[model samples]
Target: MIDYKPVSTPMSPKPKLSLTSGTLFDDPSKYRMVLGSLQYLSFTRPDIAYAVNKMSQFMHRPTDMHWQDAKQILRYLARTLSHGIYLRPNAPLALHAYSDADWTGDSDDMVSTNAYLIYLGSAPVSWSSKKQRGVACSSTEAEYRAVANTTAELRWLTSLLTELGVRLPTSPVVYCDNVGATYLCANLVFHSRMKHIALDYHFIREQVQSGELRVEHVSTKD
Candidate 1:
């Protein structure tokens, strides 16, 4: 236990839903059925994510440790039964995103994680927090990749809104904390330093130049 410290969280209190796990592996007519329900609960409770992911790794074996984790998760739910995200239906719609990367923050693989979220009047309608698929030689490269992913999500959400008759302005603003990446998206200028990034990542540049998307810079959170 000393080798693995529990990750600390700074979350405040909130209301959540209650759920029950069926049983242990014995007399398990509905073990898989129960697992399906448990899987969906991950949508709201990020607290048990690490434990659930770890328990899933040993599904074929059904080890004592896995069942222990399941019961412990139930106990945790008993205590934290009132915590969740909430959004009201009457709020106005506003689509905007903030994109960023960790800049080689991963100790395991040295690949920085890309994080972004798009909001509709303060509620997060779309969000992603993922490690880059490939190594980036510079912070600029990682940031550019993050912005590309964010741009894709923005386009998809915009199209969905249009179909739903939720009218949006001409250009959606995507904020990036990297100036170099912002410039790259708005230009075809061949800087000797950034020639190594994939050509496909440059696709956002056309979108930027055409006034379909706008990239602005912001200061990173400390």
Candidate 2:
């Protein structure tokens, strides 16, 4: 839609899509081709990452509704033709990340979406937006899982930087929006409540106790 009217957002806020809601698209091949291009575009255009990820879930059986959503992303791209990630020269060597979860975001599977964005100084270096492996029992559990995911990414990035002879001035910090999840990262008293995710609990707790990472809560408004 080169001349189509541009949209302010990539995906609609209401009427979340489902797996079996709409009639199957007649042009499945074309849908996959456009989606493939969008997937490549997402590497440099994080603004469309979440929308692209959501559309990808229906790649195997894209419906007309999914195609329309995909086109919405294209319309958004039209409005943001000049937007892209810019890594400033001599940016700080420090790393910080923001992690969040949309609890039970998937109406079909009841699975939460875990997302994290890692910044090396002012530029985003790594990011992910994917559904959790299993349904979360609570919003705190979803948020905690997101933190654990972010922590894993930080660990790898730290090791990579160390090998490259780059030492950060301070330990990496993880900003999460959930108070319960942030508290769970530093306190063992919440262990009993999170026994189901014992591995993630211990992994993040280890980093927090040893001062390798800090998990702090921030207001969602921020």
Could you say which candidate leads in TM-score?
Answer: 2
TM-score (all chains, Cα) for each model: 0.65, 0.97
Extract clashing residue pairs from model 2.
none
lDDT digits (tens) for residues 1-222 of candidate 1: 223323333121221111223234562334444445666786665455444543453455453434545555555666566876568787667678888887875443577677777777767676666778888998989999999999999999989999999987557778999988888787667545788777777778887888788999988872
lDDT of candidate 2 over 38-129, digit per residue (tens): 99998888778888889999999999999999999999999999898899998998999999999999999999998999999999999988
List all candidate RMSDs to the true structure.
8.5, 1.0
- Tell how far residue 216 is off in model 1, in angstroms: 1.5
How many clashing pairs per prediction, in order?
A: 5, 0
Q: Which ten residues in a row are the worst by lDDT in model 1? A: 10-19
The candidate that wins on lDDT is 2
TM-score of 2: 0.97
